[model samples]
Target: MAEAKAEFEVEFVGACPLWRGFEDQLAVALGAAAALEQKAGAVAVLLGDDERIAALNKSFRGKDGPTNVLSFPGPRVDPGFLGDIALAAETIAEEANSQGKSFEHHAAHLAVHGFLHLLGYDHDEPDKAEVMEARERAILASIGIADPYA
Candidate 1:
């Protein structure tokens, strides 16, 4: 049987508009990520700001502050639905600037990171983190982005 291509649906809620063509960027990122290449499903992406993401972080993960990205896995009722990934634009921009990375590259990395989480990849342990980071590096490289962990 042939593998199914993953789909992405993006919705901009707040400061996400700071970067134009974000949806296209996400499409390219997901397209280059091999993890999604053989998966049959749709991923929902919400582009928001720090405040919004912080609220989600608190409500779901019980975190106190804003994070760059958060991933919520969907139920298996519909196998075609992968899950939801939320992004904080302001937080991402700050991190990118501090880390000497382009906003686009940083955002792409976060998107891939969240997608990996949805696919059962976690970094709670050193071994697992190494594996996840390796996969992320390869995926970003395919799209001409440098190693995010470097």
Candidate 2:
């Protein structure tokens, strides 16, 4: 199989402070993944407060509230690289606090999660969860973050 030409672009659209070296780390994560065939389009990362994200959640997924991260795969997922990833600042902060992890760590984990989604990984089933999480663990380890499971 041909190596993926993964391309990444991250944007912070709200008050969330950009994590240290996050962009670089995200690029590394994209580079490490073999399944997401990267191409020309950028993978946008937007950070918003609860209200903004909640609206998006409700509109797109039919959920009633904000989520930590939402992945909107571009139309080209089947033949090439995936699309956009949106993250919520408030949710991420709350989740990191609740999970006893650093903000950077949780954000990194989410970034990996979003990227994996772009690669067609989903957690809707036990077997799928296993496969996706394993890939996440490996990629995150390469970036110096601990296994999200442990």
Candidate 3:
């Protein structure tokens, strides 16, 4: 059988130079999940800096400081217009260094994670977290990445 298809686009603002070819990377991360879910759509990813993400975090999430990744899901039923996902460059770099993973590896994990969130995947509880993480691991693995949780 032929593989399913999904569409995605990347939008970088701020100082995230590492997002040069991120569209393909994100497609890889989203591929298996999209195929399994049988959903076709486009996602807008913003690779921003700490300061920018922090402001968004504070304003939207009512939190202080920057976070690694944030997802603003669009109308769930409208797969054609999935919302946006944002990433913090500084936070991503720092976390990758601390976790002893490459920037690309960590970023792929984040992309999968945020994209999943846009697809209504959440980790607010143990069971849900397990399912989400498993999906993430599987998707990443399919794309030649390792299990991030392990």
Candidate 4:
């Protein structure tokens, strides 16, 4: 059987690019993740500040603050659609700076993380988290990203 293509879209709000080619880089990351996970469908990504993401976090997740990333499974999933992922620019930047990593690399890792969530991977429990993190490590390794947990 043939493989299914992964389609993605990027939307920017709140803040602008601190890293050049961020959107393109994200596409490459998502594309690679999609291929590795064998996911097929559209996923939307929003790059915004803490405020915008916080609002979304509140609305969808019932959280009170901004998070680094959030993933929502698309309703029409099954035969095609996967879901969407959102990232907070301010939080990502802060995390990258604090972690001594580049903004692009951190953001790319988050993008991969979110994409994996959209594909029905979760870490709600220890066993599940280990499996998910292992998959994450493998996927990120393929993209030359260091193990996030280590």
Candidate 5:
């Protein structure tokens, strides 16, 4: 049998110059989770600096600090029209260092997390978290990354 097909377009906007080829990795990640399809719209993955992302975090999430990654599904929630995923480069790097994981690995995980959000996965509750994490683990494992929660 042939593998399922999925496509993604990723853009980095902040201080994250390390994720230039992340678009390709995202395709693999989504494909691994069986969460991809040849939809009619695009997925935007934006990466930027702490200040810019912090402002976004505060404005949208009601938090007053920079976060590692934030998903902006846009006003519309259709997966086909999936809008953007934002990552704070400074936050990601700092978190990765503190978490003892490579910048690339953590970055990859963030991308996966953002993609799941696009697919309507949220960790707002324990049961939801379990399902979401399982999906994340499968996706990451397919790409040769260890379980993010383990």
Candidate 6:
């Protein structure tokens, strides 16, 4: 039988012109990661600005600021509808510039990070963070992106 591949549906809203071809890049990055290869389903991605993300952060997470990415896991039923991920373009760009990493690489990392969350991965604790970060490093490396935590 053929392997199952996850599908990504991306929507752009509010100052996300800089991410014109990001959906393709994200698909490549996610494919390299192999996180969703065994599951046939869909993941929704939103590319928005700081203002939109900030509102979401505050409403959903009780935080009052914009973040790079946010993940919302789905019910995990048949056909595996994984979840949703949102990215803040401005914050990602700023973080990329500050970290000396290419914007594409950084954005890919964040996208992967959000995807992992939908797979029930979390980094709230040190041990969990270690595991999550390790997976992230390997995934990023598979796509020629350096260790994001390094």
Candidate lDDT scores, in order, read 0.83, 0.72, 0.80, 0.80, 0.72, 0.81
Prediction 1 global C-alpha lDDT: 0.83
Residue 115 lDDT, candidate 6, scale 0-100: 80
- lDDT score at residue 97, model 6, on the 0-100 scale: 99
- Alpha carbon deviation, residue 63, candidate 4 (Å): 1.4
TM-score of decoy 3: 0.86
Off by over 4 Å in 3: 1-15, 21-23, 76-78
**Residue 117 lDDT in candidate 5:** 85
**How accurate locally is residue 85 in candidate 6, as Cα lDDT from 0 to 100?**
85
Instruction: Kindly list the per-residue Cα lDDT of model 2 for residues 8-82, writing each as its tens digit.
Output: 454445554544345565566555553343334456666666787798899999999899988888785344336
lDDT of residue 64 for candidate 4: 99
TM-scores for the candidates: 0.88, 0.78, 0.86, 0.85, 0.80, 0.86
* Runs with alpha carbons beyond 4 Å of true place in candidate 6: 1-15, 35-37, 76-79
- What TM-score does candidate 1 get on C-alpha atoms? 0.88
Report the C-alpha displacement of residue 10, candidate 2, in angstroms.
4.1
Q: Which 10-residue window in model 5 sums to the lowest lDDT?
A: 31-40
Question: What's the distance in Å from true for residue 101, model 5?
Answer: 0.7
- Expressed as tens digits, the lDDT of each residue in 25-83 for candidate 3 is 66566656566566677777788888888999999999999999999998858758778
lDDT tens digits, residue span 1-150, model 4: 996555544443334455346887788788778878876666777777788889999998899999999998888535465776788888999999999988888898899889888878889999988988898888878888888878
Can you tell me which runs of candidate 5 are displaced by over 4 Å?
1-7, 12-40, 75-79
- Model 2: colliding residue pairs: none
- lDDT, model 6, position 68: 98
User: lDDT tens digits, residues 1-150, model 5?
Assistant: 998656544444544565566556655554554443234356666767788788988999899988887887745645565767887777888888999887777888888788778768999999999988887887788789887786
